[model samples]
Target: MEKKERKRIVLSSNTAFSLYNFRLHLMRTLKEKGYEVITVSPEDGKYSELLKKEFSFFPVKSLDRKGKNPIKDLKLFFEYFLLFRRLKPDIVINFTIKPNIYGSISAGLLGIPSISVITGLGYVFIREIWLTKFVKLLYWLAFRFNRAVVFLNSEDLNTLRNFSKEKSFLIESEGIDIKHFDLTLCKEAKKDEFAFLFVGRLLTDKGICELIKAFESLKKEKPKVKLIIVGSPDEGNPNSVSKGELEKWVKEGLIEWHGFQEDVRPFYCMANCVVLPSYREGIPRVLLEAMAMEKPIITTDAPGCRNVCVDGVNGFLVKPKDVESLYFAMKRMVELGDEKLREFGKAGRRLAEEKYSVEKIVGEYINLIEAVLSKS
Candidate 1:
């Protein structure tokens, strides 16, 4: 009997970090199942090395997430088309805007099976009406030919449904790694200082400004509270806060900005609670990671954000874009004292294991892929 041909899967993302962090489990799981995985993204010196060591890397110039440039976008579209034609992949799995929209169209044109993962609506869908309509129309047309379209959150799924009135596969945001992020064995600090952690690109839409304001208010009342912010300015994202602005906040002693760190476990270890006041999310990884680390969370009531927090249960959920609400949540956590906070953290860990574990998420993707392929 002949051996089955290995399914060649081409994974496309906008950023190297996204491929490295969010899709790591998916890559490993597919490879372990004997699928040939080829990765494409805008090359970074660090990510290029990691990709070469882990999987096949096909470097391509991706559109900057920050500013709009028609010429660059066109070039990127053609570049993806050329690459897709050259690779002749069995399936194309795309994440982020450029890969999902343009890459899906390219794959569709060539009659190849494809999957598009919508991570978040972001500013593209929320801010610009004309662009949103145009993009929605494109998705309605392009997505019709794809084998599957994966959304990180139910809101995104509903949004897609609203646009196309077509059914699509909905998975909770790429799930967390419960084992990898387990906080049971984490070293506890002897000091009594309470720290709060915030992670993600420094974007205004992420509610970083609101977080800063809340932190300032919290600090005035509780001088012992510490705020540590991770992640750097997302140059590709239009709503990202400028480096200068972040620095200004840091100089004012509002919070400690850690810029971009490869490993965030240390921050998690030092933190008593994790907070994300974003306007919206597609199931935030930081909140999941923090939960896995056995840390309580404070987040907004927005679609993806609320899914992670169960109000007074695992964590507190405040209204999005509300600085006073955020401040009060932080204050309440502070008043809960260490023992109550610890209990909340434990509850969060339990939730992560039950709901957001990477193993569970990987299995969902594997099952979906196999199911889709078998149908073909």
Candidate 2:
């Protein structure tokens, strides 16, 4: 018997943190199946070091997270073009905007099969600025040459359907590691006050302001309730909330801003409910993690968000950017009592097990990759 030669697969994202955290399970699964897996992203110090320990890692230094400058973008394009030309992987899968656009185009030019995973339409789509039209144009151009276009939710798929309807694939987020985020590993800490947790980059589009306003109004009524913010300001993003602003909020005794945490499990263990007033998402990873931890959630009834919480079943869905709606929802969660909250959490966990397991997601991806390869 002969050992089978391994086919190389490249997984590219905007940041090494995303590659390590969101796609770690998929990368491990690909390696287990005998494929040589390589990850590409802008170097994120610690996360870049972590990726090198488990798999091949490449840094795209020219890639900027939120920059729209043509010169820098062209440099990124060439960087990817050169990298793909050298590695010559069988297939490349890209996540986020720049990688999906520039990286996919590079692979396509080199005659290598490529797939673009639109993680979410971030700031570019959120605010309809000149950048939005430019990005949409770039998406149309890049998507034209890809082997497959992947979307996390149907709303995103429909938004760019003209460019990718024939080849678009939908997955329920990157998929969650239910076993890792297991509720049994960390029991909810008993506390006298009810706590609301909001995790993710601190950005205006995430509805951080609205959340603060709602929490402030709610605080006046129920002084014991707390809002724990567990994320850092994303410097690259245009909508990032300044550190000064966060500090002022903290000093004002509004929120317990803990900055970013490598391990969010402990924070999840301390909260009564998770809330994300995000305008949109490819399904927020934090909300999914909260569900796996058997914690009920409160999020906006927006695109990827609506798909996560089944309003009143697993959790509550409030209007996006509506402080009043958010406040009322938080109030309901407080009044709902422990028993009802537990029921919502249980329903959320069941949903995570049934639909969003990493194994199931990876299996679907493998199947798609094989099909694409066979046809090619």
Best candidate per TM-score, number? 2
Model 2 residue runs over 4 Å out of place are 1-4
Q: For each candidate, what is the lDDT?
A: 0.85, 0.92
Q: Which whole-number lDDT from 0 to 100 does residue 37 have in model 2? A: 94
TM-score of candidate 2 against the unseen true structure: 0.98
Give the per-residue lDDT digits (tens) of candidate 2, residues 191-260: 9999999999999999999999999999999998999999999897779999999999999999999999
Model 1 lDDT, full chain set: 0.85
| C-alpha root-mean-square deviation, each candidate | 1.7, 1.3
- What residue runs in model 1 are displaced by over 4 Å at the alpha carbon? 1-4, 162-167
Displacement of residue 80 (Cα, Å) in model 2 is: 0.8
lDDT of 1 by residue, 33-82 (tens): 89999999988888877977989999987556544677887787789889
| Top of the candidates by lDDT | 2
